[model samples]
Target chain A: MKTLIVVSHPEFQDSITQAFLKTSQAGLDDVTWHCLDEIYGSDPIDIQAERELLNGADRIIFQFPLYWYSAPASLKIWEDDVLSRAYTYASEEGHLKDKELGIVTSVGYPKSAFAAGASQSFSISQIMIPYEALAKQAGMKFMKPLVIAQFGYSTDEEKSQLLVDYQMYLTAKYPFSFNERETWMIQQLKKLASGNMKNHQQELDLIIQELETGQDDLNDLKEQINLIRNKEED
Target chain B: MKTLIVVSHPEFQDSITQAFLKTSQAGLDDVTWHCLDEIYGSDPIDIQAERELLNGADRIIFQFPLYWYSAPASLKIWEDDVLSRAYTYASEEGHLKDKELGIVTSVGYPKSAFAAGASQSFSISQIMIPYEALAKQAGMKFMKPLVIAQFGYSTDEEKSQLLVDYQMYLTAKYPFSFNERETWMIQQLKKLASGNMKNHQQELDLIIQELETGQDDLNDLKEQINLIRNKEED
Candidate 1:
């Protein structure tokens, strides 16, 4: 599916979090990255052009650094000038119907800080009710938010893992569960093994066997969880 | 107290709800009304000047129509340009510390639409977590949001009542409770009775008595509620 990422960071060039995330989606042909500041810096925003970009995408992701628990001013302006005017009531049915609305936001604080008794005192989902409400109003499906917390403190290994996970979140199958990912990996390995790749066939076979075993273990754990829940009910 | 109302409506002149609210506070001294669009119409925001205005205010109110469950884009831009750079980290203690942050917003839908199983499917307070989070980060006291829902359908009587309530919200005591308002009204009546107002002394006295009776009734209701809770525990 074609994906559009509308990035809204005041200092986009200076943001290490955004820069690193951008690198994660590198060489992805189906992804269109549009920076708000670069496109409409200090100028009157072209609403038509923005609507055109929205029309061309199957999935639209609002990517930004969380400023005071919301997007920076640039994104708000874009929403007012472009989205509200064009998408809300301009037509009989809204322009953004059936499209998937997603958010990929990075917060300065750790994820643990956002809880009832924690420093933030509210979960990310609670704070993002405005977006959910907007999605409802526009007839779009609100996808679960992808939250990246404490990007500055992440180790190199974690960053590498994040790159893989972020890519999967953007372009992988819908619902993007662990089961789907495992199945995809196994399919790819089988395809490679079928080819004249005799050098890595043994290693690929071993990895495929490990993945199948892991899936079985996961199913067994799920059954155990269900049994425990039923026991508690009783 | 000096009150700064930073209004972020795109078309303030044409907005009936905002215009009516503005008339409610007409000729009020110590209230600075700054229209964001009129101040910086498609121009680069003057961050220093905006900071100066914020510093002068005892209470800062963000007044706007709730677009997509938050303020209009102009306000967000003002926040990014003015507040974040200057107020958030200019000093060890933030510039907005101890000052009150208030929201005066109007929504298109009825208040009933915002509930668990309702059309909006979330409370206004939930949708306003971003503002609360901002206030917490800035060390400012986040005032209870003054939500005006379905302004287009409100009757003249409702509008008049809103005018009184909205004024009290902006300039009354710190908490702005019903009890404080009752006390303020009684005090005003007593002061008027003390003056050479021979014609309305009896009417004023009756009004003062009614207010006192209303306060007594409210206290009695609270006591009954507490007693019922204790009984339930027993």
Candidate 2:
């Protein structure tokens, strides 16, 4: 699937989180990293070009730092100008129909601060209703959001995990099931072993073999359970 | 109370709804109808001047036509530029603390199409959560939003009622109880009778007297109920 990441941040160049996210998705073959401000700073958006890009992508991601509990003004400007009603409305032209819409937002507050009785007093799901509504209106499947909180304060280990998760969000299959994630990780490991990291190929091969065995065991357990259930029914 | 209505609509010059709202609040002395796009256009927002305007107002209204289930880009731009962290945080400077934040938004869909199982599938309250969250963070009282849906489809009587409702949203006291609305209407009627509409002073005076009598009777009934409650307590 061709994944398009439409990034919007007022201080895009200065954001460490954005820089890290950029680096994380650097080598993805099918991902298009399109930053709105970088491309069209202070210029009117070329709506036809943007619409064409949207049409080409199977999954579109709105990636931004949450400003005032929504995407920055740049992305909103893009939406207001580019997503014309004739092209967006599902009941009408339905150009974006059957595509996927995803949100990857980084918040300044702690993740725990977003809940009913928490400091933010609203869940991220509640805050993202507008985007979900947009996806609904366009007949697109809205993916579960990937929220990164307090990236500045994250430990190195957390950052590594974030890197892997960010990569998955961009390129993994829809719904991101455990099986798909494992398959994706093994594919990445194989690529790494075959590429410039040839010295670590032996270690990577061992790890991949172990993961495959684990998957086989899991499948066997599932098969045994199904057999037991079928026998009981008979 | 001084009201600062920060209006944001990309196509403000052509909106019949905005024109009607402007005319509705024409004679109000304490209300400031500041349209952001009209003032700033494509230029950068004047942060200092905008913050000063916010500081002076007892009620700050974000009036706009709904674009993509939220305010237009211009409003979000105003918010991102003008509301700095040091100025708006309730736990810190609290510049907007104890003030009121009101929303007056017009929608293209029918009013009934904004609930579960409807076409819009989200209530106005659900969609306005971001602004409400902002109000909470700033220690401001969030007023019930004035949602004008399908304004072009409204009848003459509905438009007239919308005029009154919009005025009340901007200038009326907080918690807009029935008593307060009635008091506000009477005050407005008195102003009209004493001003340019003086030719109909006799009819206005008679109507005012009838309203006053109704108020007096309601007060008497309340007092009687209180007396009965006291007797019951004894």
| TM-score for chain A, candidates 1 onward in order | 0.81, 0.97
Candidate 1, A160-234: lDDT as tens digits: 878877776677666778888877667656866877778999998998899889999998999999999999999
Q: Global lDDT of each model?
A: 0.84, 0.93
- Among all windows of 10 consecutive residues in model 1 chain B, the one with the lowest summed lDDT is B84-93
Quote the positional error of residue A162 for candidate 2 in Å. 0.4
Per-prediction backbone clash count: 1, 0
Recovered native contacts in candidate 2, as a fraction?
0.77
Off by over 4 Å in 2: A227-234, B223-234
Model number with the top TM-score: 2
Off by over 4 Å in 1: A85-92, A186-234, B89-91, B187-234
Poorest stretch of ten by lDDT in candidate 2 chain B = B80-89
Question: Per-residue alpha-carbon lDDT of model 1 for B9-98, expressed as tens digits?
Answer: 889889998888888777556888898988887787998898899889989999999887889888887887787635574245488888
